[model samples]
Target: MDQNQIPYPGIAHTIKDKKALLARVRRIQGQVAALERALEQDSDCSAVLQQIAAIRGAVNGLMAQVLEGHLREHLGTEDQTPEERRDNLKQVLSVLRSYLK
Candidate 1:
């Protein structure tokens, strides 16, 4: 499959949880803006590093949530046949493992 092509084009499951996800994203965005402002203002190094770490942790948490949703929605409980689900599981796991490294 082409790298540009998403296997699950629409996040049907995610749609139901969009508000929470979007809230998380907005928080991350706000953190990013704060980081930018800190840089512009020449904030203390320790404070900047703390902000960066917080952003990283927040992003990782968001990624984990999305990954769990993708697995559940596309592989584990999707309407596909068992064999198809297995294949998708393998593909998703492979990609996730690669990404985590």
Candidate 2:
């Protein structure tokens, strides 16, 4: 989408959804705490692995959601000039490369 077609309200969009996002984060935190407790309690190896997998999935889901919003707000707009769009996309790609690593 171009800058003119920007569907999201940028940070305001995130702020509006902050409560829901925070709730998800809290749930993930709870899961992490549970994982810690399981380790402390000498849970079975398989159980610990399951907990780790759950945490990873949760984190990945969160990352995907945030990335979607960021792309929409920053790179998917039609308002920016072509040059600006290219620059923004490059920056986005750079961040993604670093993040993926």
Candidate 3:
């Protein structure tokens, strides 16, 4: 794996949660479309801004959900050696740093 890229730890959990995740994505898409329509219709700035904020919050929520699952799934496995677990933790920390930025 490249140093710049952390391995995503939530692949299995994501597969398990695919339907709910997809639903959230679909809702975000709809929010974006609504924002576009608001722009086209010359809606008030406050309303447009509100829609943008809503989309951002929804996206953040989804990210948090996935990150939570990644930690839960990857860090608790009994099979990994201490070194392997440390490496996995480092990967997760790297991702968290980027996400925070």
Candidate 4:
């Protein structure tokens, strides 16, 4: 993972941990499906709320993992120029704004 396998820093760094990320995604998907099933079954409101919370937490965790990877690849890569690092920072800031909204 230290050696950049490709020029696309955004996702290239994830190659080393793709399996783990995919597994996290799968679990999130399962949580979402369970939430859907609960809705379909007219489950208790508290149960539904808890499921939604769990889904949100799982998604946030996944985002954190990918964002960490993206930062490490772009900001810490020795070959990257200052301009490139600034651009990466801007991209991250933009995404954070959107995510927070």
Candidate 5:
């Protein structure tokens, strides 16, 4: 069966994946809370910038994991028609561009 027609191994047991993603999201949540507290406290600009950098890194990592999972599940195999392949390629490029932004 084509890769797209089959479930990804990670997706099949996605409880683990979900938990990990949730953990990252929760940490980001905490970061946001901390940032709010920092703002309330009028923390230094440098300190706020550092926290923002950390949050950005966390978000990028999470996006990477999600993109990897999607590529493996949907783009790891062949397409039966040129039109279908072009469409999939377009989708992949669009997602990549969005993530890069």
Candidate 6:
């Protein structure tokens, strides 16, 4: 309930999504490390390009899941008061805008 941290949704809603995201990010990190090693080893261009493409696809998938979660849980209509709802919408928009950049 700290002012600096927004409340995350229920464990069932968030944990699974978070686990997936974390796994993808970890894979991306590994890919980046491999790419660096490839560069050090002077790897072939086609193999490097393939790994880069895979990393991009993984990042895009992660972003989609995060955006979907935001729309479903943070911005969805429910029983919130008007002011709270407006605040939620604002926060969601802010996050989306930041990510979209």
Highest TM-score model number: 4
Per-prediction TM-score to the true structure, in the order listed = 0.79, 0.79, 0.85, 0.87, 0.72, 0.68
- Taking the candidates one at a time, how many backbone clashes does each contain? 0, 7, 0, 0, 0, 0
lDDT comparing candidate 2 with the true structure: 0.78
Residue 101 in model 4: shift from native, Å? 0.8
Report the error of model 2 at residue 49, Å.
0.8
Clashing pairs in 4: none
Give a tens-digit lDDT track for model 3, residues 8-37: 544798989999999999999999999999
List, residue by residue over 6-100, the lDDT tens digit for candidate 4. 23444787888899999999999999999999999999999999999999999999999999998888877889788787777777777777799
Candidate lDDT scores, in order, read: 0.84, 0.78, 0.88, 0.85, 0.73, 0.75
Candidate 1 ranges beyond 4 A from true positions: 1-6
Error of 4 at 80 (Å): 1.6
Looking at model 2, the pairs that clash are 2-77, 2-78, 3-77, 3-78, 3-79, 4-78, 4-79
RMSD (CA, Å), candidate 3 to true, equals 2.0
lDDT by residue for model 2 (1-92), tens: 54433233345557766887798899899999999999999999999999999988888888777778777876787788887677667766
Which model, 2 or 4, shows the larger TM-score? 4
Tens digits of per-residue lDDT for model 5 on 39-94? 89999999999999988998888888877766655566574366655555566676
Winner by TM-score between candidate 5 and candidate 1? 1
TM-score of predicted model 1?
A: 0.79
